[model samples]
Target: MGSLRFISSPFSATIQDLGREALAYYAIPASGALDKKSLQLANKILGNPLHAPCIEFSFTPGKIEFESATTICLTGADMQFKVNDKIIKLNSIVGIKSGDILSGSWPKLNARCYLAVKAKLDLPNIYASYSSYPNAKIGYNSGANLKKGDQIHWKEIPLNVSLENIKVDDKPFCESIKIKKAPEYHLYSKDITDQLIANEFSIDSNSNRMGARLLEKIIGDKFPELKASVPVLPGFIQLTPSGTLIVILQDGHTTGGYPRIAYIPENELSAFNQNAPRKKFKFKLV
Candidate 1:
């Protein structure tokens, strides 16, 4: 048994799994990793379950130390990191021992990353999830952000588990995210729709797990009232009354007051998280 301790970090980091499903009826959010694929790859590298407790970090100056032997994997944002003075590769597994220090810095180009260990974090689960839901404070770690001197203990696993290298597509999500027109897509004028699909927008500072607000605003005629609220998924795109377009993320609200406009495909939902604050993205309506 070992304890994982955080020595330093610049951004709020939390423990997240695949997320709690079928609980939205109680107004719970299905908050989990924004990059599900990367999380899966990390767990796979250490032979852990696809949906295991993993650490997800925001902007970093991330540093951690372990007090026992454990195998771990890193994926998603390619922050510059070194384990014991040796630079390690993303999407690869690395072994560590007691008092081993791992540290990293967030680069200019990426926004998030995942670090999955062979064993699960001993966290209190809420609504069948081990994820930190900041809005609800469901996870016991209180938004799950690790602070200086905080300790994270992992559940015991067999010591003989093996590690393996995993090959990942160089940039599986490089292309523009695919979208399907929503029920109210036709409400906006042709000029609005044209601008929506062809123009590039930057993620704004207002972004969080709940949703991303884009920098570019729709300039055409104002959209008419959308009648009533409707169910919205993680990728739901809605144009606000003032023309602000927001892209929903993993911690997004289950229903939206604005008119739904587009949705990222389910298979590619996790890939979109790479479009972090100030990052630009174009869209194509399928």
Candidate 2:
């Protein structure tokens, strides 16, 4: 196996894959890449399996040095990626040789980016996945974000794969997200429901993978007490006591007492993944 050493790890770098599937039965959420479509495209370009491990960078970028030549792709946030001082374009595959350096910054348009290599990432799989779940302390490098000086191991490619041979589709990148009404939707009045769809809500500054808060016209006394620690999943829209709406994501808590008004359709998860603070989101009932 060849080693890819991280000379500089971005602020929130982590080894992310398609995450464990069966663990969800135990209430362990699948905390993989928030922008899964991007991750899949990157893998597709490299001819890697859809669930192959990749690097997820947040906020800042990092530097990686390959021990041998390898084919790689970058997707998701268009982070300012560069190889040895030369900027590389996004959504395409590139070949990196031994001694070459790969570095990048967070995308100006999105929050995170996905980096995929040709061969499988040589890491231990827990519960049938290489994805990292920080909350549960499971999978890859102590189940935490990648750090500076970490050496990423991977199976070496037999031959250098050229970017020209890689074919990446743009469909998932442009698809619209769909959301379904949750069980708690009946708790709100029709007026409140109409307001939710008609009005535009801004992404609050205080948001992350766990959930995103939306700033909207307040709705007081709406389901003041729905006290049950029921199951919650990605895209669950729960109302806070103060009437604020919180859209839960991949890393959201397993259960909560708040009333879940709706669930973002699986397709729309990517959009919410990159939603920037102050950006407006409009809901539509299907």
Candidate 3:
């Protein structure tokens, strides 16, 4: 068996794959990697399954120590990973030897990064998935975020072998996020709806995996309200009574009582999730 130990962990580090399926009936959120594109790319570079479990490091992964030799790849935000004193390029296959130390600084452009190893992570298969749902204490390490002194085990892969490095693009995330009218889009007045599509919104600092709250407010003291809770998924934009707009994310609740003003396309959710706090963006209505 092979393993990696965290010397110093990031603010939010969790084991995530594509997420669980057919569990929404029980209100289980689809807790997966926020940047799905980067996660898949990292796995692909390591010649692993597209949905292989990876460590989703948010903000940055301070440092890690390799307990066994293995090949790995990093994707998403550029944290400038380094092995010992040598810098490692992102999105390229690199081999690690026992006692090698990996470290990275805070990411500059995006919010999260993915590290995929060539072997399967020895995590619990809850709901047939390795994704962590921390609210319910559901995955590896009892669904707790990784911290210093923590180690993760994985099946051993061949060592001391040459691996082909894959060429990946510098910028993989989308530049603009597009949204479509939701079921309750007509509930708001034309003026409010226009502001939503025309004005730009900045991400709130309080935002987390559950949702991305926008800093701007469209409605005043009063707005149309949903009579009852409705099924919501990732990317559903909900307008709260406080006039704040929040886009539901991968770990957001299954049902919401707020007005679903607009919905982001599944393909665009990755781009939206990568937007850092206070990052300004305009939604293009399709």
Candidate 4:
């Protein structure tokens, strides 16, 4: 098997696929790429399956080196990476040579980025997924984030694959998120529901794969008391006891005690992940 060595890891990086499908019964999160559309684009450029594993990085930029020649592409949240010390464009396929290094800083527009290679990262499988779920102790390295001196294993590929160069559209996703009322939507008072639709909410720094707390606080006595735990989907908006709005994300727990007031589709989660802290967006009920 061939491999690539990590010269220095990003602030937070890991190999992720589409995540586990049927393991939620065991409380395992479907911990896939935060930005699936971008991940798919990277894989498409390399002719790999849409769900093929790729590197997802957030915040700080870092570096990685190739011990073998291969084709690679960086999609989502422009990384502004450089191969061989020469700057290369994001969302474009590029070639790498043995001993070549790629490094860069974070993008100005988004937070999460995807790096797809021609070959898949050799990772352990959990319920038929390669996604890393550190909370559940599943997938690559017991669901650990990429760290310095890590070796990513891959199989050798033909020389022609590395010679291909292609460009792709890197347009942004919709700024307005479409959501529907959830099972507990009625728990919110008229004022609370009206505020959610009329006001623009920003992502807080506390946001992560598990969930995010909105900057807007909805406080009032009409709020429903805490309820029994129930299964909820990723992107479900739940109000906490503190009157804070918590929007669930890719790695959210299967069951939560909070009332789910709205549905933020899974497909739209990629768009949400691109939003930097304090980035504002409005929610429209469908």
Q: Highest lDDT among the candidates is held by which one? A: 3
lDDT of 4 by residue, 91-133 (tens): 6668788899988886777788888888756778778888888
Candidate 4 has a TM-score of 0.92
Q: How many clashing pairs per prediction, in order?
A: 0, 3, 0, 0
- Please write out the lDDT profile of model 3 over residues 3-63, one tens digit for every residue: 9999986788899999988888899988888989889888877778889899998887978
Task: Using lDDT as the measure, name the better of candidate 1 and candidate 3.
Answer: 3
Deviation in Å, model 2, residue 280 alpha carbon:
2.4
Off by over 4 Å in 2: 159-177, 215-217
Give each model's whole-structure lDDT. 0.79, 0.76, 0.86, 0.81
Q: Which ten-residue region of model 4 has the weakest summed lDDT?
A: 158-167
List the pairs of residues colliding in candidate 3.
none
lDDT of 1: 0.79
Each candidate's TM vs. the true structure? 0.93, 0.89, 0.94, 0.92
User: Model 4, stretches more than 4 Å misplaced?
Assistant: 159-169
